[model samples]
Target: MNIKSILAKPFAKTVVAKIYRQSNNAVKVQQNLMQKLLSQAAHTAFGKDHNFSEIKSYEDFKKEVPICDYEALKPYVERVVNGEKDVLWKGQPLYFAKTSGTTSGIKYIPLTKESMPTHISGAKNALLHYIDETQNADFLGGKMIFLQGSPELGDTNGIKTGRLSGISAHYVPKYLMKNRLPSWETNCIEDWETKVEAVIDETIHENMTLIGGIPSWVQMYFERIVERTGKKVGEVFPNFNLFVYGGVNYEPYRNKFEDLIGRKVDAIELYPASEGFISYQDSQDENGMLLLVNNGIFYEFIPSEEFFDENPTRISIANVEVGVNYVIILNTNAGLWGYNIGDTVEFVSLNPPRIVVTGRIKHFISAFGEHVIGKEVERAINSQTENTSISINEFTVAPQITPVAGLPYHEWFIEFENEPEDLMVFAQKIDESLQQQNTYYFDLISGKVLQPLKITVIEKGGFNNYMKSVGKLGGQNKVPRLSNDRKIADELSKFQQK
Candidate 1:
């Protein structure tokens, strides 16, 4: 056993606190930790499989551990679909968090016990930072209503076979066995409808003060509140102090929610996923402080140029510069040594580098926080699109709120070879594939959290013209890997006009 691992016993919080205190920028501390992890993780994750434990130098780690999409992780996932374990790691993975990756298909991200605390502690620290910033001790004193996943703890076909944020939410705490307050723990919500109802009933008239979660979902919960009680949102919950959300951009969804509630949205950013809380916005003015779980993950940054570099490799975070985008490389506890997270981000500052996520490294749209990536989207469309002879040369997706205003839906601009006999039906199939793969998408739609889906079938050669305008029609860059909402859609529309 690697004795160096013991320093991580308390998930390295003191070290993080120390880093926070001593370092002027996050760069110095990050490099120090990487130097330690690069040497140690090789032994910690040794001999798990070809997929796990492949770290030599930080550069080798980046090259060898190729970027993975959800579909790429499917073979390991099929085992979870069949209730098998030890495939993703040496030991049994306690639960799986179903993240709807950039793909229209699902990415079931596995969260093991070792890496879970970092997630929970990061979350707690985020909250602590919030309280510190706001100077509100009562934030946690009142009922903390998190508009999040199913309040289930045990595993019973729980997101094992299918996609569900509720199920994924359930696994988060269990994986981080230490962070949770055991006495405060509740029942495993096996039934979806019942679980939601329970969550609703629990929060409705109670002293639900500190509200947290995605703005869209919080709006969904607000709708549920409005639906269950004839009273407008304001009359029911006058005590609500704050709202927290992440996953999707909040600017568009904010005004509508505020109008109904008779309150300005006091929203905060969260960098959470099915795997863990990767980062969190610490203060009102500051960008999200990357609480590097120094013990749990070894960090590496690949130059944004590395995407075009013939000899691309991961570089130390110590050496990264602000304003440059880099593909995030992670060497985490769950036997994943020197892994590239496939997401892209940039540092706002070097001293405790506050990172703002630019987008996915590989093309993928996370219109929702489902963590969708290029391959999963491609896989979902390729087999079916190819069979139908509707050759999808290229595409872009944006969250269009026009259908129901606050309730957004994925708007697809398809460049198809042939027009479908039943275009609506074709769109339905696409929606079905996505919904089946990503349960969270289905949940929001079915629950009326979002609007009815819309598909805009564009004219042939739309993508080519679109690419040309971007001045990246040919080489490594074709079009964006992902587009979130109206901004990208408008750009695409302008190109279409040309």
Candidate 2:
């Protein structure tokens, strides 16, 4: 047996045991984690301001600290950015994970020494659990390519600043470093197109067993590899049995990805963000990702129905019920207290507390009281596309409130790898599918309050060009699948014009 196989035997056994123990008592684990985080940050500026030291229970913590969004946390983040020690966390942050902002040009989320382990260890344990469950240790014998952002980190106020993936790349375990592809020089190339090309050049001939990336970019890399080698991914890397992905929903891209690989591979989904590592897909038995309860981050859930209320109800893991869409809140060792991360999720199981990411709070469309979410929209598209041979490259939906010469309607901008024979028929099917899913949407169309959905066939690479123009071309960047406003729709128009 190989060294990896030998090592994985013991490691996988340990992780499997831990998973069982944790799953059995997730609520207790989460409670203890919250207490530990609060204790660690008690003396920090934010903690002191919130009386964290005296806050002894979840109820007390909830009463003391108000839920805040990025805007509400901006001042404290700025203080940390200006080299203030113990402002949010215990010390100055080691780095800032920069992300596209909702209210501002960019958001700088602090990545502290205390919180870094949550990202690294959580990711490692996820894979370990997968191996434990599958008994698949041969993957460790070959290289694993992670298509991440540039490893060349930029400095902001004496602290490193970059994409969360880039920061995490700096800390890959030394042993696995041997099996990782793309030299540090190639990883730091900055431009995504150039970086992808370099990655393909370096990894095409290697003994690759695993590939991890945001599905869209990985698809681009796969396309390039196919072009160069004149072979499907399975032919090039027959040992490749795993595809690890997150950051965006994979359902829409599932068909195309499998086609590129020439067969379906085992996939592991992760719920990682600039703020913290939240969850991961632990077992192939279920679709929901297992929440990382014992991780450094403490989680709170506010029901999406109550999220917009002046006094929204924030509930702990003990009280959260299955099937309720909740906007996630975090109180992390990184010193964020009751901070709303903007994403909405629904619990699929309460015993182990597995969750499915439902949508983003900012990415919903309620333009005419027909509340439509990302999950609903994606389901509609998936249902419509599953019946046809067409494959989607990328898509985004927006409300066209003021069309030049027609009633207001929901517009879809789509780029297809295999175009349908009849575009109008395809569009009608999507609209009908959506109506079947959302009663509010169905009522709007039936009441003649809205016109039929409009479809715009974007040229290949239109979304990428749009993201590039807005300086958000790669890494965790993705177009909002659905939007109430026309910001994304307007930008896509500019790309079409060019």
Candidate 3:
């Protein structure tokens, strides 16, 4: 056995054991974690204000602290950004992860010394768990390229600020630095196009075994490598075996990636946010990702159907049922209490609770009251594509509310690497598939309340160009897949017209 494999054996075994133990006692583990977080922050201003001392259990805590979004906690976050110590967490945060806001301009999320480990440790344990399950520690024997944002951090008051990936880049372990690709100079390039070229130039000939990044950006790298080397990904990196990805759905890009690599490879999905690393794919035998119960973040679930209600019921891990979509609420050691990160997930397993990211709370199509979500749209596309020979690159759906003289309809903007031979038939298949998945959507179409879905084949690179124009081309930035309004659709229309 290789040295890397030998060294990993103990760590991997421990991680697998912890996962198994925690899964069996998930409710108890979550309860203990929740108490620990609350007690840790009890002396802080937020804690005092929320009467954390008086809170003894999940019920007491929920009643004491109100569920909040970024806007609701913006004031406390601003205080932290302005050099206030112990305003949220116990001390000044080590850094602020600046995330793009949906309604607001920019959100500065605090990352403390206590919370940083949740991100790093969760990631390390994810790979360790994978290694344990597959007994494939040989991946540790080869280089792994992490396509991350620039490591050059900007300052917000006294605290450092940058994208989460950029912040994480600074913390790459010293041992792995030798195997990590792309010099610091290359990561700091800022412009994705330039950085991608730099990455391709630096690692085209390296003995790479793993590639980790968002699917779209990594696909961009693969496309460039293919164009430059005139070889499939397998030929360029003979040892490449694992693809680790998150931040967006991987279904649409799966076929395209397999084609580029010239064969199928193992993939691991992660559910990480600027807030924390929530979950990761542990067992290939399981369909859903295992929840990080022992992580520093404490979790609660509010059913998606009741999310907009004035006072929705919040259920703890003990009460969460399988197959119900829930908006996740968090109370973290970073000093966030009852914060809603706007993402939605559905529990697929209850024993060792596992979840699937269903969609964003704000990212849905319900303009005409037929509430279609990201999962539905992705499922429709995947189902239809499976029956055809075409490959999808990227796609987004938005309701076209304004029609010259007909019923309103949903408009799809798609970028295809291989265009379908029968575009009209492909569009019809998608419409039919969507109808089958969502009863409300089917009713809208069947009753002639809404027109059939319209497909617009965007020129190749249109989505990338649009993202670049808007300064969100890479590093956890993704094109919103479904929207009730035409903001993204109209913007994409301009690109299509060109």
Best by TM-score: 3
lDDT of 1 by residue, 1-498 (tens): 223223233434543355467345555555555555444433322334442244445555555555544556566656755656555554555556554444535555666677666666666566555555555544443556554444444343643422233443444443233322211232244432344466676667666656666554455467667778976666787766667766654543444566557666466777765544567776678754554535466666777546657667557766777877778766555544445566677788666657877667655545565445443444455445643435443466777756644677777776554556787877777777777766677777788766545667666556656655654332112345456557657767654422
After superposing candidate 3 on the true structure, give the runs of residues whose Cα lies further than 4 Å from its correct spot: none
lDDT of each: 0.56, 0.87, 0.89
> What is the Cα-based lDDT of residue 162 in candidate 1?
26
Runs of candidate 2 with Cα error greater than 4 angstroms are: 494-498
The candidate scoring highest on lDDT is 3
Q: How many backbone collisions does model 1 have?
A: 14
Q: 450 in model 1: Cα distance from truth in Å? A: 30
Q: Model 2 reaches what TM-score against the true structure?
A: 0.96
Estimate, for each residue in 233-305, the C-alpha lDDT of model 2 and write its tens digit: 9999999999999988898888787778898899999999878899999898987999988777889999997
- The superposed Cα distance between candidate 1 and the true structure at residue 402, in angstroms, equals 22
Model 2, residue 431: C-alpha shift (Å): 1.8
- Sum up the clashes in candidate 3: 0
